[model samples]
Target chain A: MIQVENLTKHFGPVRAVDGIDFHVGEGEVVGFLGPNGAGKSTTIRMLTCFLPPTAGSARVAGYDIYRDSLQVRSQVGYLPETVPLYPEMRVREFLRFRAALKGVSPRKARNARVEEVMDLCGVREVARKLVGHISRGYRQRVGLAEALVAEPPILILDEPTSGLDPNQRRKVKDLVRRLGEKRTVLFSSHILAEVEQVCSRVIIIHQGRIVGEGTREELVHRLAGGRRLLVQADGPAAELQAFVGGLPGCSEPRITGSQGDFTRVEASLEGEEDPRVRIYTWARERGKLLKELALAEPTLEEIFARLTLSPAFQEGEAGEEESP
Target chain B: MKRVLVVALRELLAFFLSPMAYVIGFLFVFFRGWETLALAKSFADSGQDLNAFPMLYAMGLCGQMMAVLAPPLLTMRLFAEEKRTGSLELLMTAPVKDWEVVLGKWAASLVFFMVLWAPTVLLLLLLQAPWLLGAHLAAGPIFTVHLWVLLAGGLFLAVGLFCSSLTQNQLIASISALVIINLLLWGPFIVARAGWVPAEGIWRELFSQVYILDHIQSSFGLGLIDTAHVWFYLSTTALFLFLTVRSVESRRWV
Candidate 1:
């Protein structure tokens, strides 16, 4: 579990992480989405107690990050962005060292935990290879095993799949997804699709502040404004626009695409309701056949763009997309 | 304490695996053996006071130069390499205190320092064997030499670790350690020998206090255990290690 309140960090003249607030519950996988230099790494560093917040505070696993850093560190596993590993150490040796460093008690237990996490991250095959000699994908897996060696209840991984191949990326996503079922995972990534596929809730950050935070559907629906409707009808484009304009709770009808037999128009309802029934009755009365009519929500990519680029968002709409 | 031991053991493991440790060791032994044999040959030919071990203590001056060279080699990679490679983040974020990391690293380097000098223990045995074989010799000089060697070795390692902690560049760390160790070891000797200041009064005492050559010869050269000299070496070790811890902690904040 994690709770942050107005968390801020400034590096001299640069505000690496501006005032921000968010929470992550147990067993929830939260994706921290941001472009490079967007303070995502800075935020994770503060949570992991690697960097002291210049202002505000945070708590991880119920322990204050500033005051109880050791306890927080012990409770959460961290994988840094570059995965700093001792190049000369073998994969298994490094994990064992990490296990011991994380306070996995007793030699036997530490070794067993190292073995388990190696298997979990699928690094068993390269256990004896020097970390420097291993491929990038295998090295990333080794980093994951190191993070999981202590069996911490929470994992804070900064770009876990940054340099991996597509196959490796998919494998890491699957691992994160499976791990999230039993542990809290907060992983940062610039890849929107990775965040979408692996995270239940996403936190979008830009310019050192949180621009948006919510589930995918919530963000999409909030930005999409009203229920988006796509109507394809067997009629002229101008007639379809007229029909949409004449119907109640319908306006802004514009034909987006057209075929020989049907024309497609994108329209939306005016209020918290659908206009399918009104459109259907109006179509029957007008002697017009409706080919298709469906409500659609905005995509995560579009919502992300709108949230990060909009002038309203720039003025600070922090936590504006949280679910009601 | 347990965490410190874990880190320290890991540090030792890394040092043993590194080539720098062995290279420095070989050089120390090679040069040290040459110096020791020359001392023995001088005593044998001149038929001077054998018990005084003037040449042995003189060889200690050579050992001290080696001390300056050896520690920087062993210590260059301690903190500097960690920072360069970024593993320092892992070490700092682990459930270990800043003091523990500094102390652990210093302790490991000190251990390697001792290992580099461990071969000298055999040399001491061979040199002292004459007494064991019934030749007339005093054990006092042997004990004194060992004492000065231990104290001076510790001071060198501490200085070396402190230099290592100041930068992420290993070459810079090594070079800085060399300069600092030389200044500390021979700075007073240079000033005293240059004859720029009064030979008597408080300045002489001040010079003797820092003149490692004087400290080694005054306390152990005469077989006297001066608590002040002991305190000097011990306090210097503590001071540098404390500074190293502060340097490491400031790194986390910045």
Candidate 2:
């Protein structure tokens, strides 16, 4: 339900979000992946109408971000990076205030909406407590509750689980996954595993541009190229390396780690070759013991690093987030 | 309009729930009470005319000092705190117009300013009740002083709101508001007493238009409902609120 075309933002001479084009279909759970200072927050601000675009345009929920900002804002619920809240207000009070601010009409419906979100985000226990005195995890959940209070059709959450503990992070991920089933979800994060688990589609941005975008398998197969081999053997390291080195279509096998009685080595294999079978056969012929042999596809984290760390994308990446 | 009320109500709660609001209110009341008591005692001791009571009590140096300082306390945190705490982003992204948020905040501060001075006005009316019972007190002076205070409060608080909108630092907002209100409050007095330039010309007329002492303070104190002075106070208030709206709107770019 969001369309961004050549969307760009600049702070003085610094280009925070360069010309970028992307679209998020309705009911799609899309993860926006980018490292720090990668213009993720800037992009979210533009879509939510908190910041006007310096150039180009974005349409959120079928409303122009610049021309019809109020309408777009009403249709989209945004949880900013820091979860800004009035600390003196109680959790329920803040959610009620947000419900009214977001145009949740009818006295009954407004109260119902507040209660529904409080229950949905699991903040009912601390509804009566002041927001400032709550723990960080509860505060984050309250922020989420505020976003859901209006029952908007679209959600744009910037770093939904930035500072939460591991358990809280898992809870937030589960919450996002559940919410994405019924609503269009676009959340930004630098965490790879959670995004892979929760999002159906992923967009990798670097230096204000989209460096990679696709499903997890597509990215791993396309951007990361062929498969990689992880071999843990209990034998002479020299013989293993020599054997793996002589195998055809296998690049140089490099020892990755050593622990206990096993030496782990990894190598990139070209084409549709079963290197594990060859390693086993070669080990049997050489009378050496093989402890482990497993083939693993490159993960999203590796692909993300490779795509973002390329020399082409590192030019504008070093600068800090500008004033805007 | 409902959206405006949402913002306004939140502000009201923020103000009334905080201990600092009550502290500021108590201080304002104490100052006005002391001013009234001390001025009344001076009039009775010196055998000065009692007819000048309301004028001296509400429009004298004491009143001027309180008017200059009281509004900053109510307005220092209005917009500056929102900016500093990053809640302004939440406000702008909500389904409310920029002007609605501005007007809501302005209305809430104006209400709090009224709450601060309500007791003082009530006390004056109470003191005059015996005279009114005797038909010895004309209502004109009381009405005039009341109008002047109301309009003056609106104008000064508007200036403070504008100053708060200009910065993210509460101290800076308060100090700048103090400086600005002082300039507005003391402008006409300085100009009228100065021996510079012309005795009666464009400069003098320009100062008189906004001169609170000679025009607003004096005219309204005598129960003279001058339309021009009323317009002057109202338009000044409107100008500051308009500036607050513009300042808030400009933040979306940054």
A73 in model 1: Cα distance from truth in Å? 1.0
DockQ of each: 0.59, 0.66
lDDT of 2 at A6: 83
Compute the interface RMSD for each candidate structure: 1.6, 1.6
Q: Write the per-residue lDDT of candidate 1 for residues B53-163, one digit (tens) a residue.
A: 742554565676666778888888899999888888878878889898888888888887888878977876776666332345566766776777778778888888888
Model 1 residue pairs with clashes: none
Q: How much native contact recovery, as a fraction, does model 1 achieve?
A: 0.57
Interface RMSD of 2: 1.6
